[model samples]
Target: MASNPYEVEHGIKPSAPRQTRRPDMSSFHSALHELLPEPSSSSSNRNVGPTPDALRSLFTLVLDQMTALRNQAPAGVDTELLQGLIEELVVDREHPDMKGFLTQDDLDALDRVPKKQLKQGELCPICTEAFLDDPYPLVVVLPCSDERIDPATGLTIHVKHEKHRFDLECVGPWLLSKGSCPMCRQDVNAEKKRKEIGNQERKKANAVDDEDEQDIVDGLYG
Candidate 1:
């Protein structure tokens, strides 16, 4: 009979503790007779806590957010909502009453967010680079007759590419492939109607020409 592998492994060593106990910190204390050391040069300057790299990173984050918001800002976002968001980002997040909390949060939030290409003619706040990327990721704005408007700036947002509207499933790709509007998603129908109307007009013109030719033929014969 062969020894069971599981039992042999377990028998070779005792199982590790599932829950280790924490150390007691009750006796921990600073030396009462010794004078406290002076704060380090780096730690002394509160305003100097942020390194050049950190500052640059922070600036980039602000710029990126601003650019994203601006690109998303279309023709119909509410002023109050924009104002509130701006205030929160600029006043509360950048310069908070609680200190490091806001700065840390801003960096974390911005870093986690995915980068979106701004719309045509839009500028990125971070790099100050004009948005020239094709297929811009534009969110729809509100308060317009159109459901697609910038939520932040209340401006009309145009999605970068006509094909993206179809890609987003807002409209069919075939319709957008021909550069049809994405809003109503009725581009195919419109194209079909246009073709039908054009064919009818052409048929009418041809019929008139045929009748004229028949008249001329009849007159010449008679």
Candidate 2:
């Protein structure tokens, strides 16, 4: 008797092909079927449609990347032009653009903010006034409501509130004195003052040297 392949090694024939039946498509499905054109040089002349969401997605991605980069960046860099603009706003009172903004109410408020005097006690370095206002001076209240008068100067350093803190007394006179901090001596006009003082010292030193030389000449002659 011939040995059966199925009974041989592994119990299966390696060359056997599995048979499958194809599903029959109904007439309705056959009528609905449509053929897509294969690419050819002639067919390639037709315009290709872009994916609908592609441009929008690309724009959104770019915007997101820009936002992330902006979040990662440090504070802004300074520019001389911007500095000049700020200086014009604060110091150049005569700048023509500034005239229209100063109305009577604004001027009154500016004037009413009160001159800060260096009192013996209770002076806020910020407002230069005694903190008579319960919480603090109106200006000191700005940047926070907790602004209080300095115990020594009677002015608002903390524990009060106001809109402006440019101590007119300190700033005004200091600006008059070549734009420097009156109390701390931070020179805004640094170059000008340095040059002035240097020249003055140089002149004094030269005078002293001249006096010493004349004294030596007189001693030699004697």
Model 1 Cα lDDT, one tens digit per residue, 3-104 = 668878778554444331111112111220121122232434423344434433343343334334445555554334323334444543344332221112
Model 2's C-alpha root-mean-square deviation from the true structure amounts to 33.5
Candidate 2 stretches greater than 4 Å from native: 1-122, 125-128, 131-166, 189-222
At residue 148, candidate 2 shows an lDDT of 48
Worst 10 residues of 1 by lDDT: 27-36
Candidate 1 to truth, TM: 0.19
lDDT of 1 at 32: 9
Q: C-alpha displacement of 207 in model 2, angstroms? A: 53
Residue-wise C-alpha lDDT for candidate 2, range 16-127, written one tens digit per residue: 4332111112321222122112222342532232232432332233233223323433365223322332343343333222111111122223324433532234544432
Best by TM-score: 1
